[model samples]
Target: MLYGAMKVSVGAGLKVVFRPRVEGREHVPARGPAILASNHLSFSDSFFLPAVLDRKVTFIAKAEYFTSPGVKGRLTAAFFRGVGQLPVDRSGARGAGEAAVRSGLEVLERGELFGIYPEGTRSPDGRLYRGRPGGLARVALASGAPVIPVAMIGTDEVQPPGKLVPKVLRPGIRFGEPLDFARYRGMEGDRFILRSVTDQVMYAIMRLSGQEYVDVYATVAKRQLAEEARARKRKSAQE
Candidate 1:
């Protein structure tokens, strides 16, 4: 209700000035369980995609959002939840990946749509990073749901980093066909197997969207810097 209504009113108004062209919306399933996997470009991409998507797609969100302090935090949390976001900590214990996959699987098992950013986090470089494979393979193998590869062009320019408000700019969303991974269904849990399936899905997105691929997990690179920061703090305390 809130999503569709907001999209209709706000989206229409926005389009009058800065129109956003959407393509391949037929790719999104009108109903049933499917994965809307997209490349992470900008923060606004979250609201933008959901606004354009006809269905009530649920995306995996960080758990910290819910626990945020003060009124501002409360509003932010409310809006995200109101828009159908599920909380899952992506930076906690080693089991974070498994937990998120499990959450998404639960949604699928209930015959609901699940959304995920395969790259794990936003791409600072505008280049699609190598996905973590995070349970995408296992989930597909388990649920038998079709994966819809989505690509958002001009989003980065619409709302770049360090900008609070979106520039009165317009960007477009180009959705691709839903891809079936039934051929690899019978394959065992081999790393190579998972990587191949992930790449194939990403390739579909890459072809439709035409973004540069990074071949490295965005989370892994962030993890390195985070670890270094922690180590530095520890050394400072000890010295």
Candidate 2:
């Protein structure tokens, strides 16, 4: 009920104001379980993709969004739930990854579309980072669903991090053809197969988004950048 209402109200407002350019929407299956694997560029990537899709796409959000206290917290949690977001505790990396896979499989079993960011986190920079093989690959192989590569173009420019208001510029969404990994269906337990499947999906996203490919994980890139900044600060202090 709330999902339909929000889709009509918020989705309509977004289309009117931003006028997002969407393409290849036909690539999405009309009624079946499929994975929408996308490159994570901005916070708004989650909102814009679901708004434009006719079918509901369920994504995992951090548990804090659902567990915070106070009136504002409750309202925020309600909003996220209304939009079909499931909360997962992300404090432990291994546990979180396993939980996410479980959540995704459950959604797929219901014959619903499950949306995921293969990169695990948003790109610290605009470049495409390597996909984590554990969650996305496991769910794809386990559920045997077609993986659709989605590109959210110019979303970083429209709503960069820490920006209160988005710029009134057009963002684009391109859906690539669905990829099937049926040959590797029963090999989800194999680490090598997992990495191979994940790399294939990342390659498709890179082609669609036209972002520079970074072979490292986004979290590693973020840590390296932070270390560089601290090193510069230390050098300046010593000078």
Candidate 3:
């Protein structure tokens, strides 16, 4: 009920204001379970993608969003839940990945759309990063649902990293055709198969979004960037 209400009210309002250019929306299955594997560019990627879609799309968010203390935390938790987000503990990579896969599978079992960022984290730069195969691959293989590659174009411009408020930029969304991995149905545990499937999805997203592909994980890229910044600072001080 809350999700529907928000979709109609808040979602509708944002659509009117932003007026995002959406393409290939018809590619999304009108009914049944499917996985939306998208490139995560900005925090708003979550909101913008679901806002334009007809069916409810659920994404797994960090547990902190739901577990924060006090009034602000409560409100944040409520808002995320209202927007069809499930909270997953992200302390341990393996455990968190497993938990996310479980949540995604549950959503798919209910015959609803599940949204995932195959890249694992938001891109530090606009370049698309290597995808993490564990959650997305496991869920799709387990659920036997078609995976759709979605691209959220120009979202980073609207709300870049570390920005609180979004600018009035014309973001665009592109949905590629569904990718069927029925042949690898029972190979969920196979790491090689998972990587192959994830790479294919990422490649499709790259084509749709037209972002330069980076072969490293987003988290790694972020770390490298921070290291570079520290190095520059040290060099400046020495000079």
Please report the candidate that would top lDDT against the real structure. Answer: 3
Candidate number of the best TM-score:
3
Model 2 per-residue lDDT tens digits across residues 1-239: 98888888878888899999999999999998999999999989988998898899999999999999999999999999888899999999999999999999999999999999999998988999999999999999999999999999999999997787999999999999999998999899999999999999999999998999999999999999999999999999999
Model 3 RMSD, rounded to 1 decimal:
0.7
Task: Give model 3's clash tally.
Answer: 0
- Ten residues in a row with the worst lDDT in model 1? 3-12
Which residue runs of candidate 1 sit more than 4 Å off their true CA positions? Answer: 1-18, 186-188, 220-239
Candidate 1, 25-61: lDDT as tens digits: 8878788899888888888777777777666777878
Model 2 scores worst on lDDT over the 10 consecutive residues at 5-14
* Order by TM-score, highest first: 3, 2, 1
Candidate 3 C-alpha lDDT tens digits along 24-138? 9999999999999999989999999999988999999999999999999999999999999999999999999999999999999999999999989999989999999999998
Alpha-carbon deviation at 34 in model 3, angstroms = 0.4
The runs of at least 3 residues in candidate 3 whose Cα sits more than 4 Å from the true structure, single-residue gaps closed, are: none
Task: Give the 10-residue window scoring lowest on summed lDDT in candidate 3.
Answer: 5-14
Q: What is the TM-score of each candidate against the true structure?
A: 0.84, 0.97, 0.99
Rank candidates by lDDT, best first.
3, 2, 1
User: Candidate 2 has what TM-score?
Assistant: 0.97
Q: Global lDDT for candidate 2?
A: 0.94
